[model samples]
Target: MPRIPAVPDAEAGVVGRLVYRLARRRFGSVPEPFAVARHHRKLFWAALVSELGWERAATVLPATVREIAVYRTATVVGCSWCVDFGTMLQRLSGLDVDRLAHIDEYATSPLFSPAERLAIAYADAMTAQPMTVTDDQVAVLEREFGRAGLVELTQMIAVENMRARGNHALGITDQGFDAACAVPQGRSLDGSRTP
Candidate 1:
């Protein structure tokens, strides 16, 4: 359970109910963060809008590159919820989720492409304490994925940092999203066990 209880659907206002409905339709459930954030309506809407905007705008990098970088950031931050959700997203996108088992060895692992390795390394640097991101790293990323792509990549990593940190602080662990992907029909969006 999270430090703060999620606002139950019955207690959610009209607008919150609509947003929750949309979330359930999109991701098979209202994310715990969304439910918790609904306690503060304004911040909830801001987060919802920001997430949607970023999802639409972040199309500069290849899906694989963008997703791997974000996943790497989540892992580095040790956010179980982000890791679980990221795994499900990667699987749904048809990326090689199996390769994630070798993430810690990505630098030398054959499972990751050279480009993926670069992005993963960048995520590590960006997420590290004191942020080890270097001038050379930025230059390399820029060279590989133009200026616009680099900016998009940076924004994605930064956003994941915010998400992972917030979730961790709130004690939000895995919501079984990865498991839900395996047997989607068996689970309900409201987190109820269905027969």
Candidate 2:
């Protein structure tokens, strides 16, 4: 359970009620983060709008790049929820999710491309405290993907760092978004989001 109780359906406002209905229809259930945010009505609605806005304005990077950077942050922060969700997102995008197990060995693994390795390295730098990002590292990224792309990449890594830490600090563990990919465990999805 979250620190606060969710705003129950019966008492929700017009906008909140509509969003809740839409969430249920689209995602099979309201994601716990949204439900938890609903405890603070304004924040809940703002978050919903923000996420929808992001969806409308497509991410500046490729799906694989964005997802990998997100996955790296989740892996570093020990946020099983992000990791689970990231894996599912990757799989759904038709990326090679099978090689995610080699993430820890990306430094020497041939599974990832040079560009991917650079992004993963950046994720690691940002994930580390007192980030050890070097001038040379930024130079390499600049050479690989000009100034705007570099800025976008850095911002994404920083954002993921915040998200992973926030979700982990809360009691939000893995919602098992990758239920089918890891194994065939017969667990109940009873209390989790269906998306």
Candidate 3:
């Protein structure tokens, strides 16, 4: 259970219902963060808009690189919800989720490419206490992804930090997205059977 109870569907106002519908459509369930955020209408709306805008924005980095960095940030931050959700997203993006088991050895792993290793290292530095990101790290990332792609990567890592920290503080845990999605034709976040 979260430190704050999620606002139930009955209590969710008009805007909440719409947001829930959209979230259910997108992620197979309304994320706990969304359900909890509904307690504060404006905050919920802002979060929804920010998430939607980020999703629709174009990025230059390959999905694997960006997602690996984001996933690393979540794991480093100890946010179970982020890890579960990130794994699901990575799977849906057609990336190999099996390699995640070796994330701790990314620096020496044969599974990760050179560019991916650098991005993962950067994520580690950025996620460290006091943020250890360096000029050289940014320079290398810029070379690999260009200035625009570097910016996108930075923003994504930062956003995951925010989300992971928030979810951690709220005592939010994994919602079984990985397990749920694993079940063939399983129920969605809304508890409706997926075809």
Candidate 4:
């Protein structure tokens, strides 16, 4: 359970109900964060809109590059929920989720492409205490992904940091998204979300 209770359906107002309905349709269940945020209506709506906008607009970077960076950040931050959700997203995208087992060896592992290694390194830098990002690293990324793609990659990584940190602070755990992915199609592992 989270530090605070998730807003129950009985307390969910009209807007909250709509948000829950939409979340159910999109991800097959209401994410715990969304339910928790609904306690503050304005915050809930803002979070919902920001999440939708980012999903719709974050298309400039390759999915592998973006997802790996975000996944790396979540792992570094020790956010179990983000790790679980990221795994499910990567699986759904048809990426090589098996390679994640070697993620800690990304620098020397043959599992990751050069582009992925660069992005993962950048995530480590950005997520480090005091932020270790160097101008040279950004320049190399710009060359590989172009300015637009680099920007998208940075934004996605930063957003995951925010999400992971928030979820960690709130005591939210995996919510079974990874297990959901392992189960047969059209079924959820814990009846929370579908793979």
Steric clash count of candidate 3: 2
Give the poorly placed runs of model 4, Cα more than 4 Å off.
180-195
Candidate 1 — worst ten consecutive residues by lDDT sum?
A: 182-191
Off by over 4 Å in 1: 180-195
In terms of lDDT, model 2 sits at 0.71
Best by TM-score: 1
Candidate 1 lDDT tens digits, 1-195? 999999999999888899899889988998999999988989998999999999999999999999999988887777778888889889989998887866778999999989999999999888887788999999999999999999999999999999988997898888988853222223232222369
Candidate 3 has an lDDT of 0.82
lDDT of each: 0.86, 0.71, 0.82, 0.83
Candidate number that wins on lDDT, 1 or 2: 1
Give stretches of model 2 more than 4 Å off: 3-8, 56-58, 180-195
lDDT for each residue of candidate 3 in 56-153, tens digit (9 for 90 to 100): 78368888899999988887777778888989888888899888877878999999999889889988888887788899888888898999999888
The model with the greatest lDDT is 1
The superposed Cα distance between candidate 2 and the true structure at residue 97, in angstroms, equals 1.7
List model 4 lDDT by residue over 1-195, tens digit each.
999889987799886888788878867778888888888888888988898899899998888989989988887777777888888878978998888867778999999999999999999889887788999999999999999999999999899989988997999877786863221224221112245
